[model samples]
Target: MAVKLRPAGILLAAAGALAIAMPVLLLLPGGGGAVPRAAPVPAPIGAGTMPVLARVYERPLFGASEPVEAPADAPRLVGIVGRLNIDAVALVKASDGTTRTLAIGESVDGWSLASLAIDAAFFTRGAERVRVPLPIEPGGSEAGTEETGR
Candidate 1:
């Protein structure tokens, strides 16, 4: 009987050849040289404690201050130029002696035009209120500006 070489036999021969050649290749010049070298090492710090840590400082974003006060002489309402519905355009004589036409929500002398009535307009600053009235006219709808007690 004749023994035939199969693919399996050829692979086995190649593996054996590589196994035997590997150690011999390692012993050659570039592989495992005459003298072996050591691995790297880190340098030592000088004789002292670890370095001191730094400190950080911060400040407030929105700082608080004293509250603002209203002017000593606030605005005064003198008369109403015209009136329609519940809103009226007021002629205000300010503390500075200047006459100004003010509508509701307008600010003068640190006071705001809070509201309006048929015969008068009201100015306010915090808890303070000033009422200015329209002059009485002959044969008018209302007799005069009523004194609204607050």
Candidate 2:
């Protein structure tokens, strides 16, 4: 007795094979059809608008003090650009050195003291909502330029 392959099964197998080959075909270069290494690809940002990191004052939320290292679409970008800084000012007279006081932004203050729920933003799903802690300092000035984390 010989096993007869059904047409539906054959079609399904063909479909599966095609589905698997789709990526391979796409990766193949036009000329020699060479398959290169699969590198990480970031999703496209909004049209005419890219992801911007929110930054206020001297410190940046997504990058170091360096100007070029900062990331765009950061929460600090929103706060600074929007100029929406909401927090109280605490003045304390210290007997230490000069009259230098430590002032933190509302978001930073909230996060540091466990006042607000602050979690590292993860881009596993998508760039829907990337919450970043606002600047920490009473009169944090705005810094121009934005950067995006790759």
Candidate 3:
């Protein structure tokens, strides 16, 4: 019997030879193989060195100190619609004798409405705050009483 080689057989032999040699070549020394290394550890921060985000978290979102009394020239609270603190609206009489409607955080005549209650509205200007009471009628009822039913 005579041995014969075909294109397909030659290609199969070449592939098998390469497959067997690859692992032996990789295992040889100085073959530029990857070496396992320990992971790097991070250093601890010093007490004097605070991150920017840490400094921001240390400050208060709103001013926490007690506010001074408001000035006499501040606007007067006329009436308040709605009793809830979050959704209440305050009517104020400005120094110029004009009526203005304000909500929490709204500004009138340089004063910002900081909070609201059923009978009072608080306004703030810088470090000063004023508690403007709701107007009272002659019948001993607060203003807007008929509307709010309180």
Best by lDDT: 3
Report the lDDT tens digits of candidate 3 across residue range 13-108: 999999999888888996647888888976766845756887888776875545445478888887887767557798899989999899888998
Tens-digit per-residue lDDT, 1-150, candidate 1: 999999999999999999999999898888766676688875567626544444212333353343234345756556665555455677777888999988888988888888877666667879987655554566564545556788
lDDT of 3: 0.81
Tens digits of per-residue lDDT, candidate 2, 1-150, equal 999999999999999999988888777777336658898987677645744444344356674465332234322312221111344232222223222222243222112211222222111113333334444444554344345579
The candidates, ranked best first by lDDT, are 3, 1, 2
Model 3: per-residue Cα lDDT at residue 81: 78
What lDDT would candidate 1 get against the real structure?
0.70
Those runs of model 2 whose alpha carbons end farther than 4 Å from true positions after fitting are 31-150
Q: Which order, best to worst by TM-score?
A: 3, 1, 2
TM-score of each: 0.36, 0.23, 0.46
Compared with the true structure, all predictions reach lDDT values of 0.70, 0.39, 0.81
Runs in model 1 deviating more than 4 A are 1-72, 134-150
Query: Which segments of candidate 3 are over 4 A away from where they belong?
Result: 1-70, 143-150
lDDT of 3 at 56: 82
